[model samples]
Target: MKKTARIAAVGVIATLALTACGSREDDGDKKGSSSNSDSTSSSAPTDASSPTEAAEQYPDFKACMVSDSGGFDDKSFNQTSHDGLVNAVDKYGMQTAEVESNDPSQFKDNIQAMVDQGCNSITTVGFLLADDTLASAKKHKDIDYSIVDFAYFDDKGNNTAPANLKGLTFNTAQPSFLAGYLAAAKTKSGVVGTFGGLNIPTVTIFMDGFVQGVDYYNEENGTDVQVLGWDRDKKDGSFTNDFESTTKGQNVAEELITQGADIIFPVAGPAGLGGLQAAKDNGAWGIWVDTDGCVSAAEYCDILLTSVMKGMDVAVEQGIADAAGGTFSNEPYSGTLDNGGVALAPYGPNADIDSDLSAKIDDLKQQIIDGTITVETP
Candidate 1:
């Protein structure tokens, strides 16, 4: 049997220096790039048991997942979360099922299909699916349900989820702040930019941290690197209005480039690929989100500076494991700098960042982890 491990709440930061190649065969059907790492546990399982053994161990346990509108190939959170479900199937030999939602209208039906299929634990990807996931969880109180990028709380700050539901959320603003600082340091034009797929909290949280990081860099270095496409105070900025349109992404990026933004950050999932293309064509640097661009979209490696990543796969696999092992809890799992749940990818090989700036970014990470610095969220 594969040994079960709880995802740690705190740990030493994981090294993220990686190199890989990826391809995009179609503009509309792009898939996320790939990378590898163990779970947060100090002694995470290193080998998988035979399928026979796995089934025998968890004969009645079946895990299922539902993807948001971006589908599993989004090259962002959906892909990463799907990877976690696959990891759990491989490690635990548990039975699994999955469905993709091509639109918001399918959320309820997709989740209901999993429940009807007799899934003991269901994991839903994306913040947009929260209401549907909650409804399903409430109706099927015996089944465990976990949603990515969302927590079960109200405006007044009270937990409203059923005892069987858990949230798999990440504080990505922390790492995006680091990415912003790096962009500020590397931009020759003295300007950087960021845009999101939507104005939602999950998307804007990245923008919030990034703009703040630029501000911090200006404060410390006496440099006034301006940020375009986002204004933190107004809580407003540019957005693609959707996560699947590369055309919109590219157009928004071009607008920022035209405004003298030499570095562009796109938090728009598959749509962000267009932004990267825009940066490459315009001779600007690009910063990717959710996964390392070099690994997820290697064709743009030459122009990518780095990536702000959330360890969704690690958390998702562990959440399923908890359900399978009878150790499930409804407490929300928040990925943060202190917990190795979110990180800034190492500078790309062709990136202009130097040793001094790299070291400074590392110092910033440590400070954030140690509470010497605080990164606000939207």
Candidate 2:
């Protein structure tokens, strides 16, 4: 994912670019741009997508990425996936490119663009593309395709059910356990909170591991720290339905703080920024998601107790390596804390957490990784 600074930079670029475009648009309007609009709008849809014949006709040897609707500068999932593509380019000298989807309808168009550009292997970076990923794979059967954070299956054995496709997923709960335990240990208010961006499996999987960690801690250490935001026991915790609403995130965190929760983990994307701000203002601590918030968002970095680190880079690296070796498998590969795919971000102010508690959490981490302890995801 992009660092917060980079996202901020992108915002500036978008603004400057928009201003320049506005000026040009104004001048064009005076020059009778009605015809230009008519031609552009009329031709846009047909030209938006490359034909299957064109994709089949192109030579394929490069790697490409079709980001989720969030785009490459979202500073979260989309950005992290882009980092993986960048790594592939640097290490393999592989030609690489990326396209952002503004909505679900653009999924196929984005994929087709890369395919027509002769990319042999392409990565789709979100679960929202589940249907489109499979459909495109069938249409372009000869291409090697990989989808991150999603899986798809079709009843037909024709082009859609190809063996050349690989789906990348991870056991996010392992690192989430560490986040929950850290929140539990660092809370001065004796209560903690967590919320998700959406109710999807990818997001709730984190909650599952977090609840297990909190429950395990209370059970083993006799700490009656009440989790305030989401009910880990029920497996249905606080969720904002969308990831872009900062006000909702802030409100949720505020309520949790009112209930004595001094630490909050918000698994929402940019919306989580609100939770962090709330934590800071309300004298609470917070946990970040996916990437390292401490480094990603340096302004609020210090307030981040820690982050649930998911090794998207490692997973992406493995996918590219597999494609190169011609050994990519459709079998879902899961990355765990032990497998080096996920874990807890380094402690900041909570670095000096209770030695005994820290050791216990470490032991639990190892147990979960080694199959001795099971961390259930809701």
How many clashes does each candidate structure show, in the order listed?
2, 2
Worst 10 residues of 2 by lDDT: 14-23
lDDT of candidate 1? 0.79
Best by TM-score: 1
At residue 34, candidate 2 shows an lDDT of: 10
Task: Give the worst 10-residue stretch by lDDT in candidate 1.
Answer: 6-15
lDDT of 2 by residue, 1-378 (tens): 321111111111111000000001122112210111111212111211221222222223466777776555554566566566655544555555556665567777777777776767888887778778887888887777888886554565233336767777778888787677766667677788888878788888887777777777778779987776566556577877767677888988888788788888888876777888898898778777776665455456657666776666566756775776677767665667766767676555434555676676677777776888877763
Estimated TM-score per prediction? 0.86, 0.78
RMSD to the hidden true structure, all candidates = 9.2, 11.8
